[model samples]
Target: MNIDIYSPDAYTTGIPHEQFKWLRDNDPIHWHAHPEGGGYWVVSRHADVITVSRDFKTFSAEQGFVLVDDLPGDILDMARNQLLGMDPPKHSPLRRAVITRFTSRRLEQLEPAIREIARGMMETARNIGEVNFVESLAGDLPTAVIGSLLDIPRDMWPQMRRWSDLQTSASDPDLGGTPEEVNNASIEMGTYGFQLACERKDSGADDLISLLINQEVEGESVSEAEFASLFVQIAVAGNETTRGLISSGMYELIQRPELYRQLEQNPDLIPGAVEEMLRWTCPLHYFRRTATADAEIAGQAIAQGDKVVMLYSAANFDERVFDNPMEFNIHRDSNPHLAFGHGIHLCLGANLARLEARIFLEEFFREFGGIELTGEPAFIRSNMVHGFKQMPVRLLPR
Candidate 1:
């Protein structure tokens, strides 16, 4: 079956459910020729996505950074070392260092601070009856939280958001720039991180960046360049993905007010509601992995070095996995959503993202009795980052 999953046009209408439905029914592991030279296998079924993610030895993230199109050599190298890209032995120790700080105990301690930030954001939105939900409210909250964690100056939060926005919005005509522009932004951010690391190394501040700089990993401290790359990854990844969750979650809730009211009436349902929101509006559409050896997935033969993309958005809505997959149910019980992904390469900041979303929603509804879109919301044009680009909303103060 000739599939055109790589075309940005196919995703313009959103998720391409019809195409995915066809793939799931006829060819769960379908191949499509890439417009940019190589081809990739599109993994549609939930079971296959889980299988591929679990069998990391066969499907390597390090082969190529998780995108349908191959990246430049330098960028590819940087991606290979990121927590999302590393395989086995190298991945373990770096992940361990950061995972320690992201533990449940640490998250619990950070709750009050996160809630305070959420409350403040809502208060600011409450003061202004009408605001761009994506910009005025949802966008900056994640940056502030992540910035605080990394000991980054609050004044630079907007710059961090700008860099992240540019990096992720590859399909938006206004935001998308030439490859040189993107690379320049990466360099600028990395330079900034290196400068910060140097200061932390000399001054010896007790913060996440300081810890990362000083702490030994596998008998040696993380190199300056590695630290810079890691810094960019954390700041950009944390900000973009969490922002998508907040903005997209609110958009979906307002569209399905019955479910929204259920959550508002029963605050206890917020956690499950967040999971359902993630299922319905999965922040990332897909992540790519390259086959390291010849393998058969779901009965389809995949050759070595062939690119494979796990369609998480489609998996979340897989009929076989999620009953009533299309419905936005706040009370969804067995929502085994792939929003945070799965297996060894699962999202490291999943807990923090969930906590941010739950608290943000609670505070939002508490401050505003109702949220309505003042105008038609706009979606980000990228096939990768699936979420709202602009959401003009009115906050009816309680």
Candidate 2:
């Protein structure tokens, strides 16, 4: 097969599952050349992805940062501060500090507020009748939830969303700006976060921002600069990925009316359906790691400093792990999808994303009697971010 996964255009219409399947079957550890320079190894099998994720000592997230594209020296320095891009000894303390706030107990306390946000957004969508589900409906809830968590002014939520979009959707003309603009958005966003950390540090406030800026783990506290990078990752990640989950998940349901009604009739089944959504419409396609030492993945010899990318979308459908992996079955007894990734670097907001998705579905079913696509959905033009950019739909009010 002529491999074109490197081009964002390959994913413009939809996921290239055929290519992924071919690669997984024939070359589980296939090496494909990057447009920018040399080649990198692509890990497509579920077990190998897990192996690479678990053995972070040999496959370092910090060496090259998490992105497949190499960043400039200064940008790499900024990215190293993010929890996703840090290795053990240094990764543990910061992760512990942030994990405290996202524990199950904390998420339980947060459920009511997230439900209200989802409820309000759904009601407004019902009132509008026809809307772009991605923007007017799905996107706002994440921004609101994260904004409320950090106590950011409501007025700034849209700006943060824009900045986050620019950073993640840089390959899309409609969604992202030029390279210079993208850099500016990241800088401006980090500056704003730094300002918040400075103001909230030692303030004894109860919001998430205060919790992060003031709390210490292993006798070390988060510096303002550190918090800035953390803030960018948290805010941008929460908004972009969660929005994709809700919107793309809904799009999938809209395609299958029977499943939609099944979910609507039994709202209790929404959690299971959410897991299928994460697997089927996985928000991220891949994340890269650099090898610290020569290693082997599925018998493929990898040299030190080689870039290895775990294809989450492909691994989610690996036949060895998931039965009838292509089918969107919500009743799978054991669905171990790598949508939130695996091992220590798993998504910090995993539970929060689940809570938001479940609540959004429940509230959406409550507020709207039925929903149908009014126009063809258009996906974002990016290889990394797999989601609909615009989904026009009419919501029939309950």
Candidate 3:
């Protein structure tokens, strides 16, 4: 089949699974041309993706900064500070420091706050009766959770979500503005975070921002500028991916009523169902890594400095790794989907996202007797973010 994997339009209706399947079967390490000029290698198979993710020395996230399109020099410098775009040694110490805030114990302690947020949103949903799920319900919990963690004012929560949406979904017309506006949003958000870090320094406050600002990562405290980038990473990552997980997961469950009822009846199965949703939704499509040395992946020649992208959406459904890969099975015995990615740069908030999702599902089923699609769900126009931009749904309160 003809393929235009780079085009945002290709993914608007849904994931171009057919093209991905074709690439996986025929050209697992396919070379695709970039819009700017040179091309990049797309790694489709699960094993190959894991291989690239693990061997960071071979494929360096810091080199190209994890996007298909290269950022400008100044922007690239700031992007490198993000945990998503850092190499080891530097990446390790910082990841260790920040990860402490997202540890299982911490997430467990934070569960009540997260549950309260979810329940409140569900209550609002019940009152609304019919509304866009993405805007009204699904986006609130993550935004609020991140806000609470940073001790951001409740009033600024909407602006936080707006900044995150502009940065991550710039390809979506409804959600994003002009390229200049997108760049400005990043700058504004970073500036706000930088100011926060400066204000919180040495204050001995207990919020996540203060903890990060005061604590010594590797015998040195985090600088305000570094914290600015880190803040952008955490806020954007927390907002976009979790929102996608919750909204798209609900959309999937809404489509399968029997499965939905099954999950509602047996809430214990919700966690497993969340896994299925992660596998099915696969929030972010791909993250690019530049090769440090010459390499060969799946017998395909990969020269030094070649852009190699691990296609998570494709790898999650690899025929070798998953049986009946296309089908969504909550009870699938073994699921090692790369939704949060793999290896050293694996998402720091992975467990927290899981906690949020599980609670969101539990509270959702508890608050609403039933939910039906009021209109066809509309996907955001972006190759990177896989989610519903608008899902109009009517809720029946129990």
Highest lDDT model number? 2
* Candidate closer to the true structure by TM-score (higher is better), 1 or 2: 2
TM-score of each: 0.96, 0.99, 0.99
Error of 3 at 382 (Å): 0.6
Clashing pairs in 1: none
TM-score of 3: 0.99
The weakest ten consecutive residues by lDDT in model 2 span 118-127
| CA shift of 24, model 1, Å | 1.1
Off by over 4 Å in 3: none
Report how far residue 150 has shifted in candidate 1, in Å: 1.1
Per-prediction count of colliding residue pairs? 0, 0, 0
Q: What lDDT, from 0 to 1, does candidate 3 have?
A: 0.92
Clashing residue pairs for model 3:
none
